[model samples]
Target chain A: MIARLRDGLAVYFCLLRGALAARMTDRADLGISMIIMLLADLVVPLTTLLVYQHGAGFTGWQRDEALLLQATFLIAKGIAFPFCFGMIWTTTELVREGTFELLLLKPRSTLLLLLGHSFQPEDTGKLLGGIALFCLALPNVTIGADADSSAALLGFAALLLLAVLTLFGFALLMTCLSFVWIGNSRLQEIFDAVSAFALYPHGIFTRSALGWLTWVIPVSVLGYLPASVLLGRPDPALPLAVGGALCFVLVVIGLWRMMLARYASAGG
Target chain B: MNRLLAAWRSTCAIAYATYQEWAAYRSHMLISLFIGPTYFLVQVVIWQALLADGGTIGGYDRTALMSYYGAVLIVSTLVFDFADWNLQMLIRSGKFLTVLLRPMSHRGFALSQKLGHRCLGLWMEALPIWLILWLVFSIRLVPASTGWFVLSLALGFLIMFLVNYCVGTLAFWLTRTAGARRLIGFLRDVCAGVFLPLALFPHELQQLLFFLPFQFITYVPVQVLLGHYELAGIRLGIPEIVGCQALMALLMWGLSELLWRLGIRRFSAAGA
Candidate 1:
């Protein structure tokens, strides 16, 4: 078991190193790309400042808490973007150009290979921006200085993992759709609208709307739940919401397999 | 005069062909039908959440904000520029040589295609948008005159085209600019008040933004539709702001032309 685990680790690192090496050749382009995406990361904090200065915020959340929610989102975006958020586009191009056959020839899992092969280090700018926002908002957020605070922070950290997983799951689902529907990039556009909607506080939504985004769409899992956990005001529906997201991921993986099965290589 | 007439004829022919190309599609038409209204609804919902009591937020009361955004839904949609994405692709794929191989300038072709797309968009999107705004939001264009509003819309289109065209021309020097275009395009959309009223911005910042051409893209035209725009803390009536926007649009058009001339000389097909 130890040897097998070590072999898997070796394979993963090999693929990751290859991706990093390819990106390092174009240092200038990578820097510029990161700066460009970082500009988008900066917009949320700016808007939060504007909204709160107007003396209104989402019902239960204060301005600083809203900023924290946005930071959680940006951090997840930054991590997922570098690992797999961009796979939807990469997979579409690969399938369209008939190069996906090369990916299947690899002995490793195709999805794992896709994850490593499409790393976008340029998204680290978003990570930097998120960290900056988190630091700026931390002083203003109302966290108690007690042992319960440590437990809450730990809970918040776990929810952050859940947010990243949900985000990556969404990207994987989109990538699967690209395999099934070659040249139909329009379906990918809806991801933009869905994500843009996800940045708001959960309070802005009604109970029904909240349930829908949480259970049906899992958009709330992207940012709101983690932020809510940190604020010590997690909804009574937390377990159902998290279970719904896990079930959604399971559904997405099943769909992904079906899509992969349907894909007949253009090269063949 | 003969040369000018030939150019005009070429533009019209391309416009006709492109219009037919787009009109053949039903799915894209359906998508266009939703894009404007969906974007407008996002703004409406967010603003509604923030403005819970329905009193003034910045300088805009709730009704005024609704009217501004309602007009925004129409005008911003009409003036949308989709050239930068296509231009970057053409350059990166070495398809731009096809334009140089042809007799007409690339800029002319780009503008003609845009006009065709927007023409179809108008037929499908404009009337439905007005109905939705009127029925749902009770919004109307309260311009000083129909003539000035129409002029403002035309100039806004020209301004949008010029701003995007300038970015598109950067493909001549850059390796691939799709990423740059998306980021800059988002920045433009946000700064131009697609997602919120620029009037909601503090007055000093608004005054500073007034000097930038980005404000002319959507803010000035919407203000013209609303019959007044504030500049330097002075409220300018519709005619004055429209006059200012006309000059800015003309200036951007000239600058885009100059940039295109400079950029084409740097264009190298073999390396691309």
Candidate 2:
């Protein structure tokens, strides 16, 4: 099992390196794309800033705290987008052009191969923006150095991992949809709209909406839950939300397998 | 007069054909019905919580803020243009040569295509989203003055097309323009008051945005719809601002034409 894991890592890194090399052919475009990715994600945070500056804010959340929550979402997106999210678009194009069979013929797991080959270096701008905002906001918020702070840090770390996994699940789900949906480029826009709810404080949402976000859609895991945990104000439903996120990922994986089985290649 | 009539007829034909071509992707357009409302819902939740105490932000009460966002969604649906993306793809793949071979100006053809696409969007995206905003959100988007609003919105549409066309012109020089296009497009949207109202911006930033051509695209139209125009401490009646929007549209047309002339000289689709 260890040997197989090592082999998988080796294959993933090799394919990632190739993707990087291909993207490096256009360094200027790569740099601009990265900046664009960063700027695009910063829009919500900017609006939050302007709102607070204008003496309005999400109830129960301070300006910096709200920024921190949005920063957490951006960081999660920063991590997932460059790594996993490209699979959706790649699958769309590959399937549309009847070239998806090329990936299927590889000896490696098709999922692994697809994930590896779809690395997007430009999206690292999102990571940079997130980290920058995180650093900027972390200084302003108070965190006691007591045991609870430590526990909160631990919970935040765990929830952040779950957040990344949740995003991966979403990417996987969209990729699976792309198999049959064909030529539909608005999948990302739909995801963008849904996940946008994660950028704000949970206090802003109505009880029903909050329940849906936490228990059904697992949107809370993407940012709000992790940020809340780090703020040392963990939601009472944290454990349940975590479980929902895990189940969501598991369901997505199952869906991916079913779709793969159904994918009677474009036969290019 | 006969030549002008022929131009009008061909424009209509092109628009109708483009509309039919895109009707196959109506489901794609219908997705906006979901996305627009979802976004508005998020805004609703946030603003409802913020102003629950009866506090106003930037001189807007909850009702006015809701109207602003609702108008934004509707106007955005009407004036939306992907001409930049379409044109860049054409240029990159050397498919624009086919356009040049046609008698009509590529700009005119692209505008006709946008008209067709937006006609579809008006029904599939704008109208339904308008109903959702009205029926579900209880946000009534009664324009301050209907005639001036319509005129301003038409100007907004023209400005948006000109700006995107100029961005597409960059593909003639750059081997890859996706990043540049996105960067410019995003900045344009930001300045145009898409994500946040211009009133929410700092005084200095608002002043700077006033000089930029983008606010003519969405901000002016929304403000005209809302029946008030004030940004960066400058106030204008609907007629005056709409006039300014028209002037900006003409300026954008001149800029786009200049860029097209300069960029077209660089086009080399020898093999393609």
Candidate 3:
């Protein structure tokens, strides 16, 4: 089992290296794309900053606290997007061309192969942006001075893992849907609108919206829950939200298999 | 007169054909029905929370701010154009040679296509979202002056297409323009006040924005819809800003034409 896992990791890195080399052929475009990705993700945070500067802020959340919350979401997105989000676009195009079967014929897991081949180096800019924002906000906001700092950090690490896993689940779900939906590009927009909620403090949402975000959709785990943990203020529903995220990931994996079985060649 | 009539008819034919081509993808536009309102709802929640203490930001109370966002949604939906992507793809794939073989100007053809696409968007995206803003959000977008708002929006549509066409022309020089396109597009949206009111920006930045053409795309139109225009501490009436929008649109048209003339000389395409 260890050997199998090592082999999978080796193949994934090999594929990722190839993607990076190909992208590096256009050095200027690569740099520009990375900058664009970072700037695109920073718009909301900038808006939040301007709001605070204008004397209007999210109630009960200080400026730095809100920034930290959003920066955590960006960091999770940064980690997920480069590693997993490419599968959706890849699936859409391959399915359109009836070329997805090439993956099934490979000796490895098709999902792993897809994930391996879909590494987007440009999206690492999101990670960099997240870290920058996180650093900028961390010093201003106190975290676990009164309580156990190490425990809060450990809790943060665990929730961030779940956050990244939930994003991976979202990518997998979208990729699976692409196999059947075929040629639809608006799937990401839907996710963007829904996930926009994850960037803000949970205090803003209505009681029912909070329930939907935490239990039904599990978006709260994507950023809010993890950031809340780091701030030494984990949500009362933290355990339940984590369970929901895990369940969400499992359901997405099942849906991926079902969709793969249903996929029929559209190419002649 | 005969020649003019022929051109008009040709434009109509092109627009109708483009309309039919996109009608099959009506589901794509319907997605906007979901995305636009959802984004507005986020804004509603954020702004509602921010202003829960009964204070104003940038000369806008809670209701005014909601109305501003509502105007942004509807105005953006009306003036949205992807001519840059279409043109860049045509250039990069060497499909532009086919356009050159035609008697009509490619710019005119693209504009006609945009007209058709936006006509479809008007019903599919803008109107529905407007209704939602009115019904669901209770943010009625009653324009301060309907005539001026329509005129400004029309100019905004022209300006949007022209600015993007200028960016698309960069494919003539760059081997990869996707990065540049995205960067420019995001900057344009930022300068145009899509994410937040330009008035919220620092005074120096707002002063600089007043001179940039991007503001003519969304900011001026939204301000026109709201019945007043002010940025960089400068204020103008609805008719005055609409006039300025027209002038900016004309300037953008000239700029696009100049770039197209220079860029087309670099086009080299062999038959596939």
Candidate 4:
């Protein structure tokens, strides 16, 4: 299992390097895209801060706790930037345009190839801005004041990586659904819209109904649960994280195989 | 009079064409029906949680906030223009030539097409949701006066439509304006009170947002609908909303036309 994981990571990095090379050829355009993404990254958290300050307390969480949640979201978004958003759009487009045939000819797995082709050089800017925010908010985070910063950061990182995997897997699964359903663009839009809810602190959604949706939909997992754990709030079910991570991997693998089976070659 | 008739006829034809375009993609529409409501449900759930402890967050109660957000979702979606996507495609495909050659004004045609699309969206999608909300929630109206509510809501759609057009027309100057579209979208959601009530924002930010035209698009209209604005309040607010929208619309219109002319000149000079 370890060796297989290592191999997958290696392939992922190799694909990323190739994408970077392709994007670097248009440095000026890439720079503009990056700037735009960075601006977008700042708008959400800043706006949320403004909202929280005005509202005083969000659900039960205080102002600082809300800020910490926003920071964690930024961190998870930083992880997602390079990993998922770049690929999801292209995956949908390829399926729609019947361009997956070219991908099939590639030696790499089609899922990886599709994701690899979808890299946005601009996302690096979003990642950097997120990192900057995370750093700025790191010291102010008091929810987990008892825990060592190092331990919290490590735990945060683990949860963030898990979140990204879950998000990417979910996106992949959605893209694969396009194989069965034509004109699934609305599904993509719905995904985009629902994901926007992640911008707010999840503490605002502590009720059981919303909680179920968060866990089942896994959008809250992207930022909320991990942030909670890191902040030294009562730990969420460990099994939830482990189960979600396992489900993500299994789902992605299943969807990829299903997509491959349905792959009718586009005309060369 | 004849010109008005001609314009009306052309607008009707354009409206039909817009409907047909959307109708051709039946699957997308069906999916949108499912998807839009599901996303709205998620938002409702979140808001429900926030309000569970009772209202009075940033001076908004649960019912009021629901009315505001429900109006936001319905109104924003109703007034949304695909002009940005259209402008981008036109520029990329070098099809601005066809639009320019037409005897009718391109801007007029574009605006008509957008309004037509929005109208179709309202009939096909929004009306159902509005009916459902009215039936299920018995959503209370705040503006008290029906006439005022209707007028304000119309103005809201107009402001939103103009903003979309102005933003989209920037594509004439910028090679790619997706960033601008996204930025404007984010602004609309945050400042315009689509995601949360604008009342929930810090007083300073709320004050600043009041100055911006975005609030006129979604926030003020919804506020009016929820009876947050009175006839007296409308006397003060309506002028501000309309004046700001008109000023922004004129400024954007003039700027986009200038850019469009310049872009056309550039294209012609380059022998494209």
Question: What are the clashing pairs of model 4?
Answer: B142-B226, B142-B227, B143-B227
Shift of residue A61 alpha carbon in model 1, Å: 2.4
**Stronger candidate by lDDT (1 vs 2):** 2
Alpha carbon deviation, residue A101, candidate 1 (Å): 3.6
What would the per-residue lDDT of candidate 4 be over residues B146-224, giving only the tens digit for each residue? 6666766676776666667667666666666666677676667677777667665656776687667777777776766
Q: Write the per-residue lDDT of candidate 2 for residues A29-146, one digit (tens) a residue.
A: 9999999999999998988887888788887788989999999989999999999999999999999899999888889999999999999999999999999999999999865334
* Model 3 RMSD, rounded to 1 decimal: 1.5
CAPRI-wise, candidate 1 is acceptable
2 or 4, greater by lDDT:
2
* Model 4 ranges off by over 4 Å: A1-32, A39-44, A143-151, A196-211, A234-236, A265-268, B30-55, B132-151, B200-211, B228-259, B269-272
Question: What would the TM-scores of all predictions be?
Answer: 0.90, 0.97, 0.98, 0.84
Encode model 3's per-residue lDDT on A90-194: one tens digit a residue: 888888888888988999989989998899989999999999999999999878656787888899989998999999999998887786676888888888999
Prediction 3 global C-alpha lDDT: 0.90
Q: 3 or 4, which is superior by TM-score?
A: 3
DockQ of each: 0.36, 0.86, 0.88, 0.35
Please report how far candidate 1 places residue A122 from its true position, in Å: 1.8
Worst 10 residues of 1 chain B by lDDT: B26-35
Clashing pairs in 1: none
Candidate 4 residue-wise lDDT, A128-245, digit = tens = 7877777777677674558776787687778788877776776777777667665455555656666666656655555774555455666666677677777777445655755756
Candidate closer to the true structure by lDDT (higher is better), 1 or 3: 3
